[model samples]
Target: DVKVTQSSRYLVKRTGEKVFLECVQDMDHENMFWYRQDPGLGLRLIYFSYDVKMKEKGDIPEGYSVSREKKERFSLILESASTNQTSMYLCASSLYSGRRYEQYFGPGTRLTVT
Candidate 1:
């Protein structure tokens, strides 16, 4: 079975603070993603990395950045946290087959930016 783990289950940070959210996958999947879940907007993609040192901006990447230095690790960086950014952040991993790939998700990190 594939396993994905997030660095924190809950995080509280003040406005303008730099925050780091970490995710790790054991399956060595080729694609990794970061998303933010909100009540109305649902799941919105933040960033994704298809390979080591490669990154792409997702639907919402205005204030976030991502890093994939190693195959097993992916990190999401919030340059400046804001109250509007408070949400449940999810990390997912999947192998990119020709067809639709099944993504395995982590438990998520609930971020509260005050």
Candidate 2:
């Protein structure tokens, strides 16, 4: 089974602190992504990595960065956590080439920046 594990199910931070969220996928998928889900807005991609050490910026990569030094591990770094950044962060994984390449999501991390 495709499994993605997130570092935290919930997180609380101050207005301007650096936060790091980690995700790991056991399926060895070539594509991994980080997204944030808000109330009105659907899931917006923060960043994605197609391969190890290769990354792509998604729609909202303004205050975030990512690292994919290992094939199974991807990390999302929030340069400065803010109240506006409080949202549900989801990590997903999918195969690079497949017929039905639907992303498998993690449980998600609910971050509250106070």
Candidate 3:
């Protein structure tokens, strides 16, 4: 089975503190995405990478960034985190081409910024 592991399941930080959320997938997929989920805003895409060192900004990329140094690992960075940034972070991996290109999501990292 394909597995996605995150560095932390929960995190708490003060406002203005920098945060890093790590994710790794074992499926050797070409596409990786980072999304933040809030109450009413739904799941908003933060960033996505199609290939190593290649990234694209999503709908809500204001205070977020991403890194894809390797094929299996993708990192999400929150520069100067704030209370508004507190939410559940999800990392998903998917193949770029297939009959079903559905994304497989990780367990998610709940971040609370106070």
Candidate with best TM-score = 2
For every candidate structure, what is the RMSD over all alpha carbons to the true structure, in angstroms? Answer: 1.0, 0.8, 0.8
Every candidate's lDDT: 0.95, 0.95, 0.94
| Minimal lDDT window, size 10, model 2 | 93-102
Check candidate 3 and list the clashing pairs.
Answer: none
- Candidate 3 regions off by >4 Å? none
Q: Number of backbone collisions per candidate, in order?
A: 0, 0, 0
Model 1 residue 1 lDDT score: 86
Error of 1 at 6 (Å): 0.1
lDDT of 2 by residue, 13-79 (tens): 9988999999999988999999999999999999999999999999999999999999999999998
Worst 10 residues of 1 by lDDT: 94-103
Error of 1 at 51 (Å): 0.2
What is the overall TM-score of model 3 with all chains considered together?
0.96
Q: Which regions in candidate 2 have their CA more than 4 angstroms from the true location?
A: none
